[model samples]
Target: MKIGVLALQGDFDAHRKRLEELGAEVVLVKKPEQLDDIAGLVIPGGESSTFLNLLGKEGFAKLKGFVRMKPTFGTCAGAILLANEVENPKQVGLGALDITIRRNAYGRQVDSSIREGQFLHDPIEMVFIRAPKIERLGKDVEVVATEGRDPVMVRKGNTLAATFHPELSDDSRIHQYFLDLVTNGKH
Candidate 1:
């Protein structure tokens, strides 16, 4: 199956390499039209608002439509984009996940850190870089991973989101889980 990584900004290459390492065909999706070519999509970490500006009206609309139908995994700013409600000066989002996300809740770039989190039954290393915080989860949303009491990774239906950069770490489980999700056609 072909997996597309939103490559307009952020560390998209990392996700691409990680997905490729996991034995899936990878696409660096720089255009909205590329969405039609992939079975699943990975929206990488970046400045959320800039993602909006970069996507513009047409691209953003295309993305919003795609996420609702395809399996999508989003990290950092990508998570912000997938949220239903955005905080820290609220902004519009794709509304793919029933979540309230607060941008940069983990502090700034200088404050970024490598932390441990529980991913389902396993302990995983999570890289947080100007990360957002999952403030509230709607009833349908399930916590897939957490750092302390805060949810770092969450999912609902075909949409999966992470406040941390799973691709930045050596662990392949998170990406693997997403692959499994795509493979099994699970939410």
Candidate 2:
């Protein structure tokens, strides 16, 4: 299956590499129309406001529709973009995931860190770089991974979100989970 990585900014190439290693076809998605050629999409970590500015009105609207129709995964800033609500200076979001996210909730860039987290019922390393925190989850949202008491990874329908940069980690389990969602057509 082909998975598209939103390559507007951030560490999108890392995601592409990870997916390719997992034996999946990868697409570097820039324009909204690229969404149609892939089975799933990954919105990579980047500056949230910057991503919004880059997306503009047309791209943002197109993404909104694409998220509703397919399995999409958003990490860090991408999580912020998919959130229903954003704080630390409120911002517009795609509203694909029913959650509230606080941008830079882990602190400034200086506070970026690596931590051990729980995922797939096992311990996994997580990388957080100016990451947005998943503040709250909706009733239908399932907590798939967590860092201590906080929900770091969540799933709602076909949309998956994480507060950390899984692309920065060596593990492929998270991406594989999303891939399963893509192949199963869970949306």
Candidate 3:
């Protein structure tokens, strides 16, 4: 299956490489038209506000529409964009997933860390770099994993979101899970 990674900014390259390693056709999506050719999309971690600014109105609207019709996975700041509500003010998002996110909830970039946690069916090494935390989840949202007392991974319908960077880690389970979602016609 072909999966697209939003290459507007952030760690899109890491995600692209990971998905490719998983044997999926990886597409680097820069323009709006590229969004149509992929079965699924991944929005990587970056500055949420800056990423939003880069999208402008047209790009943002198109992305929102695409997420509604396909399987989408978002990480870190990307997770914030997918949420229905954004905490810590500056409210900006695509509202693709029914949830609330708080930016930099884990502290600053200097406070970034790597922690081991069980997400899904395996132990995952999570890298939290100024990541947002899932604060409030909707009824349809299923908490897939957690870091201590906080929810780190959550899924709603065909959309999946994580507060940490799984691409940066050795584990490819998350990407594989997303691929499974697409291949299984979950979207």
Candidate 4:
């Protein structure tokens, strides 16, 4: 199956590399039109506001429609984009997942750190760099993983959002889970 990584900014290439390692065709989507052929999409971490400005209104509209019909996995800032509510309140997002996110809740870039946490069946190393924290989850959302008391991974139907950068580490289970959602037509 083909998976497109939103290549506007951030660590999109890392996600693409990991997807390829899992034996899936990867596409770097720079334009809205590039989204058409992919079965799934991955939105990488970056500055949420900058990514929104880059998307513009038209790009955001198109992405909103795309996620509604396809399986999507969003990481860090990408997760911020998918959230229904942004904590700062000034930033606009795709609002695909019914959750509220507080940007840089883990403190600033200098405060970033790595921690071992329970995400899935095994322990996963979580890298938090100016990461957002999930404030609340709607009834439809399910928590997949957590870092201490904070919810790090969440899912709602075909949409999955993680506040940490799973791709930054060597684990591909999260990506693999997303691929399964695409292949099984779970969306």
Give the candidate number with the greatest TM-score: 1
Output the better candidate (2/4) by lDDT. 2
Clashes of each: 0, 0, 0, 0
Task: Give model 4's TM-score versus the native structure.
Answer: 0.96
Per-residue lDDT of model 4, residues 105-156, tens digit only: 8787889999988876578999988999999999889889898988899999
After aligning candidate 4 to the native by TM-score, how far in Å is the CA of 16 from where it should be?
Answer: 0.7
lDDT of 1 by residue, 40-146 (tens): 99999989998999999999999999999999999999999999999997999999999999998877789999998899958899999988999999998999999
lDDT scores in order? 0.94, 0.90, 0.89, 0.90
Ranking by lDDT: 1, 2, 4, 3
Q: lDDT by residue for model 3 over 1-187, one digit each (tens)?
A: 6899999899999999999899999999989889989999999988888888888999999999999999999999889999999998657788888898998987887989999888865678999999888889889899888888788999988889999999999988888888999989663
Runs off by more than 4 Å, candidate 3: none
User: What C-alpha root-mean-square deviation, in Å, does candidate 1 show against the real structure?
Assistant: 0.9
Tens-digit per-residue lDDT, 1-187, candidate 2: 7899999998899999999999999999988889889888999998889999989999999999999989999999889999989999899999998899998887888999999989966999999898888888888999999999899999889999999988888889998888989998662
TM-scores for all candidates: the values are: 0.97, 0.97, 0.96, 0.96
Model 4 root-mean-square deviation: 1.3
Alpha-carbon RMSD to native, per candidate: 0.9, 1.3, 1.3, 1.3
Count steric clashes of candidate 4: 0
Give the better candidate number (2 or 3) by lDDT. 2
TM-score of 3: 0.96
